[model samples]
Target: MKTYFPYQLKYVGVLFVFIAIVLSCIGNVDEFMRGLLAGRNDFETSILNEEATKVDQTLAYQPYFSEKEKDNYLKISLILSLSGFILYLFSKEKSEDEFYQQLRAKCLTQALLVTWLFTGLIYWIRPTYQLNGFYILQLHLIFFTIIYVYNKKWKFGTE
Candidate 1:
């Protein structure tokens, strides 16, 4: 298949993935802070005390607190990372050719097979663990990218 995006799009993909990672970090930290706060109920059982949630007002609870914001960060980050992954997948190398196309196809197939095996192992070891289809696809995409990058154009830049 013909590449739809220019090599420059890889930069955009990198940016998106970076942003997604940052957002995910922020979300996890927020959840952790909330848990820590919630756990510090002082010498009482009530959590409505000012000392519980007055930690300089975290990024997630600024201005007002809403339950919706708790989950939105995760969803937004996932969407952004997925978008970035797709852009990077379709973007062309500076020197794309038939050989590169065949290599890409082979890498993707290998990634899929490896992902399936990994998923199966995970399930077999931890039957309680659950993975969604989207997560599986995301894992496959990551495997494909890593394989393709190392195989085709891994380099230590001096610039």
Candidate 2:
């Protein structure tokens, strides 16, 4: 069995996550720059001061890849975060042994089962609420980490 992510990519994954975090916090790139120059949050100030016009308010409703691209940034950040997380999770460990591979497979299977169950329960409880790709990915990552930690700590701790 081969590892899809090289051990060195662990550092890259961390960098990607950091970048994603920064991206997620950023509201509008143009506005952030303006805020930096003005030494304040330009968007909020504009709206609060009644300086934001109808056109400025309509910026968020623009096309995804349009000039502003407010929501696009958030979507990109989410995708980068998920990709980085998976890369980090599956990256080769120091040992890279058969036991580790088997454990990874087992943990992933258990994670998938648990994520599906959780998703079903959430929908059963709230039928009108919709789950997005990022939400599902987060659940998958959460369950995978939990299962992986449990297996490593309890099932094979003595080994």
Candidate 3:
């Protein structure tokens, strides 16, 4: 059963989710290995002797996400992608068929701009709490922005 998404935003959403999942898995693995090695032997002791009492603190900042938040992001991403896919299905063809493309491009561009504003505010606030999911959302915003910009300027279509 195919649904409509109003535009082809679903592919973009899916791509974002896929990228986020892969990056998150990689990050988790790296963190687990580092923790494991730290506790496996005298490595931590050696680090302590090196006068680095706060070795872990010096590492790259890892965003923290509550279990509920993680689940929510995943669910939202899936829903958004599905909606986009459905829109694509229900779209009607114009005489030139460029109107729909342009409309979708504009919509995506607006979404990206809005998201960028949010992310910019996040950067300015110097937040005490960080979350990997937030970063993923920001990335998706930029990604969609780029896609819209590219498609909007292409000469292949005329609205």
Candidate 4:
């Protein structure tokens, strides 16, 4: 079968990574602003009162993103990360042979394994409250790192 991603797709993957990073940074800044603003007594009291009766029953003092803003960033970041992953995964190799195909499969499997294990470890160690906004942010980084390491180790079909 023919490869779906051309050799040029590697560049697209890189571009997606850049976009993800920028969007992630903006999300982080928004989070920081929320936290900073929440420190005010009036905002803190209002938030606590508003959230105390919610079903979550957790801390009522936590910072929250505006729904629209959070959803926009989440959707954009997810799309960018997924696009980057697909491009990186299917991009044509220099020598698209049986060995390269085997290596690609191996790498993909290993990456999934590593990502799942790492996520499990984090979940085991960290509180759910602490994991809120950071989960998606870390997921993209983990995926990129795994793919990058495998590509570097295999020299991306250079063998």
Off by over 4 Å in 3: 1-53, 60-63, 96-159
The Cα local distance difference test for each model comes to 0.77, 0.75, 0.53, 0.66
- Judged by TM-score relative to the true structure, which candidate is superior, 2 or 4? 2
Instruction: Please report how far candidate 4 places residue 40 from its true position, in Å.
Output: 13
Q: Give the C-alpha miss distance for residue 58 in model 1, angstroms.
A: 17
Candidate 2 runs further than 4 Å off: 27-68, 153-155
So what's the TM-score on candidate 4?
Answer: 0.63
**Which stretches in model 4 have alpha-carbon errors above 4 Å?**
34-66, 127-141, 144-148, 151-159
**Candidate with best lDDT:** 1
Query: 107 in model 1: Cα distance from truth in Å?
Result: 0.7
Candidate 4: RMSD to truth: 8.5
lDDT of 2 by residue, 18-128 (tens): 888898767456656554545443555665666555434544432224445767788888888888877777898876899888898888898999999999999999999
Q: 121, model 3: CA deviation in Å?
A: 41
lDDT of 2 at 7: 89
Candidate 1 lDDT over 16-62, as tens digits, reads: 99999998877677566656655554433354456535433432343
Best first by lDDT, ranked: 1, 2, 4, 3
lDDT of 4 by residue, 1-159 (tens): 345788889789878968987886776676676465546544546767765445233323453556688778877976797777667667887767776567666665666677677777887887483454545445644674577555856666444
